[model samples]
Target chain A: MQIKSLNDCNVVQMEEKLDALTSDEVEKALMGLIDNGAKRIVCVFELTEYISSAGLRVLLVVAKKLKKMGGELVLCSLKPLVYKVLDMAGFISIFKIFGSEEEALKSPQEK
Target chain B: MVQGVKISLFGNLILFLVKATALPFVNSLAILSDLGISCVALAISIILYYSIKLADKPADPFHNYGYSKVENVCEAMEGVVLIGIILAISVQAAMNFIHPKHTNMPWVGFICSIISVVINFIGAFYILGLAKKSSSPAIHAEGLHYRLEGFISLAIGISFIISIILRLNGLNKIDAFVDPVATLLVSFMLIFPSFNLARSAFFKLLDASIEESSKMEVIKLLGKYSHKYCDFRDLKSRSAGRKKFVELKLILPEDIPFKEGHALAIALEKDISRNISESEIMIKVEPCGKDCHYIQKNQRCPYL
Candidate 1:
């Protein structure tokens, strides 16, 4: 999956679903974005379903990356069952989630 | 599956006899019209039972898609039957309006309508509970059938009682007209449920996406992964009831060993399974290149 960079913020709009292999590619893409000074990225999951532990670990890495830079990461558009898994893993409270892609893009965070 | 239908079948039979037998004796048009709907309900229940049994069967070499569409077909057939019955009653009721007869046996019909209503209510509640427990489309359709029958019966009872009230004031002709008017009213009741059932069954038969929310969730997950990967594009999915089949293409680093990349795919599969139940994922891990799009779209290698 490709992470398209937004002109307005460090947030990246992911265009596909993330699994272990996909998450690795996503991590590599995030590393490139992080190198480009992209901080406090908002990840959009508009076309994605099912995130495994490997996928979660990738997100955790991104969260860690943002934390070191005093930035944040947010997730949006999780289905009830997927959201349930995230909830079970205590990820809901850890990440900021908006109801929609547009809302996640504009989620208020400390600059 | 057949057992569920048998229960509904017996319930509908009782409702029909109560309405049909009592309505003519009581000289109430509305109750008689309502009674006609019971026949439709019974027909639908029998069809539903057969369809449920068929749909519940596992896929075979002859039918790879399983038998899920059987339920939808049964539902659509039920809708058609309902429409036909409603039209027949309307025509019959119109004939009665042209030659109205004095009704002295309305009390008898009224009692019968009451019995039908009680039976329908019990049947609807029972079938609805079973539908919920089994998640069977046929059972749900059966419950809806009884529920509608119950409503029609109530309407018929109310119309007759009004006729009775009017007859006491010496407007005997008004009592004669109640049955015809009730027939027209019952026809209107069938319209909504028939249209709704037909539409849902058609959609299911077409294999249309039944769960948009789930798809969106999947999309969002893919988009999130983009932060780590690049050149990810082209995702497709189809749903078979509760099962979701997903296919996608992703770009992996060329330097990554083939074994590592294969492992990555396996890991991603696990993630998808964890997030969505009964999911199958097919991934094509491609290297970032100008020919990638062509390869995905045309399946031809420009270099070759």
Candidate 2:
């Protein structure tokens, strides 16, 4: 996982296979960004191929935390399989998704 | 659990033989009650050992849910046998009141009772520990029976010693009542646990739900993903002997792919099972109907 600042939001580049063993690290890293005062976060899932319920649980938790603190979380560059998972779980509507990093960063009304 | 039951079976057999051999010669209600409890324990331990083995059999065409309930039935029968033995002791105790007499060589009965008490207690505690590790109800029931038998034997031994001392001091009348009174007291002490075991088994026979703490764990796990789905319906849980069952229906957004919904269900099922050992779980998923607010608004689902 890698975190970098871009414009007003911090982008978290996720790893492949967000399952039981890796969900905790992904959660902690994303939550760490909020702890470090980064708001308006975007998670780029270009490298992630598979996800488990634990992974989805981490995302749900982080999103809710950010929402409660008057911040937002968005996603971009989701691989097809990962997008299908989010969509199939009915989580797509709850999160804002974009086709590219530049589009997510440029769109102010996505949230 | 298997080792615990094995120890209980052999231990009860040894105690029963010792008391049975002494009963005809001792002529004391104290000795009789000791032998009676041993007989009951031996019978129950044999049943428990086999029930543990039978309960491990997997589900087959003849039995859809497997043999787990055999342990519960065996447990209930054990309680029934204990009650039967207690009643027998009570009858014999009442008989002794009418014809009370000092026991013949009560010192022999005391020594034998003391030895059996020590052995029963050791075997009881050992089996209880094994039950905890294996989580077998049959072994737990056997352990408890052994412990109770140990206490009864202790009471029997103490009464015999009291009789011995009284006969030596020429207090014949009091010694005559000692054995009967001790039998009465021990029988009274055993009633609650016997009835308790029977009651617990009755509930299990009806397929009662899992424990409250385990149900809470299921609820807490679902709460973590509650926001992801539209609704959950028909949640239910039950237990049979050592087996726990949890089942529910989950409703998700209409556009969620069937396999994705299944994945979520499997995840939650596995999580809930992990919380409660020896559990079976089933989660069925249904897509939300057109009555949901999203469908009512006539808005195209953005994800779709």
Candidate 3:
């Protein structure tokens, strides 16, 4: 039940299944970070399993808001199941996906 | 499994004979009522023996659903017959309140009732264990019936012991009333359980859905795996005898390979069935077919 929110670099470590029941909590945490003027986010899904449609909706909304604010939402270390769902939902082409948190952290400077 | 039923059959017949023997030597309506139920149980055990055999038969061309319903039929029929027997005894017990026949040789009846109680309890526990191990509808029904029989015998035994103590203290007049009161109390206690047996049979016959708690467990599993598929609908469930059935439509991605879809469907079924015993699950895996909103908008959706 414990979800550690954005740290010094706006990196949020996600865990477990993110479905209809849990998507709201995740949305709230991510939205809070954006509202507090935090940007250039890195979401690490090393411990995450799958993201349902509701979860995808949360990502889509946050990613769109971040883009409007001239910021970016990056994802890394996605399990196969999460990857398949995001790819199927057309989210693969929307956000910057990386193999690890270090690669995601270096992407902003590379850009 | 058959061994358990056979033991109960012979054990109940012996208890009935012992009670019948004590009935002639004593005058107690409580003992009479207990003996009456013994007779009913004997008949039921006989019917149940054959029903178990028939119920264990595998599904054939003639009976695609198998013979499990035989146990339900026997339970309904037994319940109705038991209610009738109880009603007759309750009336007789009421008459005894006015006439107040003196209870004779209550000590003998007390001893016989204690013996019946012990034997019934032993047999009840043994059969119940067998029922759990086998998971046969017929055997489970038998175990429940035996447990009820044990309770009745225990009640009768307590009544007889009280009557014997009353008579010994020269409270013969009050003791005369004890038997009838005990009979009426035991008869009323038996009604709800008998009615419940009949009601459960009817529910199963009507193909009632499983309990809500069990359905919730299945829903939780679906939620955990919701990401694999787009959406699911038409979650249906039912029960026949001890067997549970669950059917639903699983909407997989349109481009998902057939082999992966099949494996996902099988895995889902296995996970669900593990929570429900004696279950059969059927899932229809279908392509999204423009089901999602993005697909309908002709967006960059994979399924589209």
Candidate 4:
């Protein structure tokens, strides 16, 4: 896990683990970050092997929370296989994703 | 779709005979329910087959999107049919509860239930195996239908045995409750897959995206190439079926003739295709002023 802060309340984190995220873990790690003053977050994955539906569900919940807060959550650096799963589920439009962590962080931040 | 139906129809027809004959002798609601399921399965199988064949046809001038949604529509219809069958069986079973009858041929019902369970199970497995081997949505739906049918048959069998045991214990009303409950259970199972298939097909027909991250990947990859080629002007993209459509605008230096710009576009397209095999990219070349903003946005263009 790699977490970095950018301008204002924006933060970016990367996770290389391909394991399915339990709801508790999602709430703990991601909700914890949001509560700790991350208004906008970008989760980048490098060296990730896969992202199952369970992981996707967690991301969906997180994304919804961020949206409710008027903040955005982006994802970046997805492996091909992972990308395919996201594509098949038609989630590409729901989340902001970039090819690189730097680019994702730089994308039109508010405040 | 036709092939799927024919196979299902034949198999169900055989099951229907066994169940119908046992229904009269044993007067078992479970057997009757199984018979009803077999009949519905056969009917839906036939409907789905023609629809699938039509849906799989190549896109013609009139319908550019092709007929893929036919399978989904068929699946949805089949789901509706299953729901109706279940509801009818449920109502009938409930009525039977109010007016209990003497079932003298309990032994025949027991034998029929056993045969129905075995045959339906085998049929479901055979169809599902074929479905898994081929990515035929129709077959998948059909196979699921059989699976529910098999489950219903099994439930009926258990109900008969339970009925006999309960009859001895002076609780004959138990058998009256089994048919409706079994029908309802099968309905829920069959309808769920049908609803799911319909939703997927509805989205597919609307030309939904492959995945969210893949779309972003496409945008990022295209943006990178745009900066390398020239000052990025415009980027537009869409997805249809299994292919992606990408169009990007880049301004080449005025000094570079049309031939050079065209060559650059070809090279970039090749690079993109090589990188993403599933993409069908279209890049538009535009001549820009020497003071290109892309140079400031990105340090240099190696492709240039």
- Sorted on DockQ, highest at the top, how do the candidates line up? 4, 1, 3, 2
The alpha-carbon lDDT assigned to residue B234 of candidate 1 equals: 56
True contacts kept of 2: 0.00
User: For the second chain of model 4, what is the TM-score against the true structure's chain B?
Assistant: 0.68
Docking class of 1: incorrect
List CA RMSD, all candidates: 9.8, 13.4, 10.6, 9.7
Report the first chain's TM-score for all candidates.
0.84, 0.94, 0.88, 0.84
lDDT of 3 by residue, B9-103 (tens): 99889988998999989867888888888888889889988987888798899998787778778777778888897899999998999898887
lDDT of 1 by residue, B1-304 (tens): 4666788888887877776677557766666667667777777777676666777688899988677667767777887778777788888888989998765567776677778788888988988888766656667877888888888878877777887888889988677888788778888988889878877767766766535444545544554554444434455665554346676676665555788667776766666656766566788888755333333455333222
For model 4, residues B188-235, the per-residue Cα lDDT tens digits are 555566566556656655655445454445444444443345444344
- lDDT by residue (tens digit), candidate 2, B57-125: 899999998999998898889888888988998998898899887788888888888888899899988
User: Which candidate should be chosen as best, given DockQ against the real structure?
Assistant: 4
What stretches of model 2 exceed 4 Å from their correct place? Answer: A1-111, B294-304
* CA lDDT, every model vs. true structure: 0.69, 0.80, 0.77, 0.63
Give the C-alpha lDDT of model 2: 0.80
Docking class of 3: incorrect
Looking at model 2, the pairs that clash are none
Residue B107: error of model 1 in Å?
1.8
Candidate 3 lDDT at B122 equals 86
Where model 3 places Cα greater than 4 Å from the true spot, the runs are A1-111, B296-304
**Could you list the iRMS of every candidate?**
12.3, 9.7, 11.2, 13.0
Instruction: Kindly list the per-residue Cα lDDT of model 3 for residues A1-111, writing each as its tens digit.
Output: 343443435888875877667878888988888888766778889989877655665675576555434467889999998998777555676678999988887765212
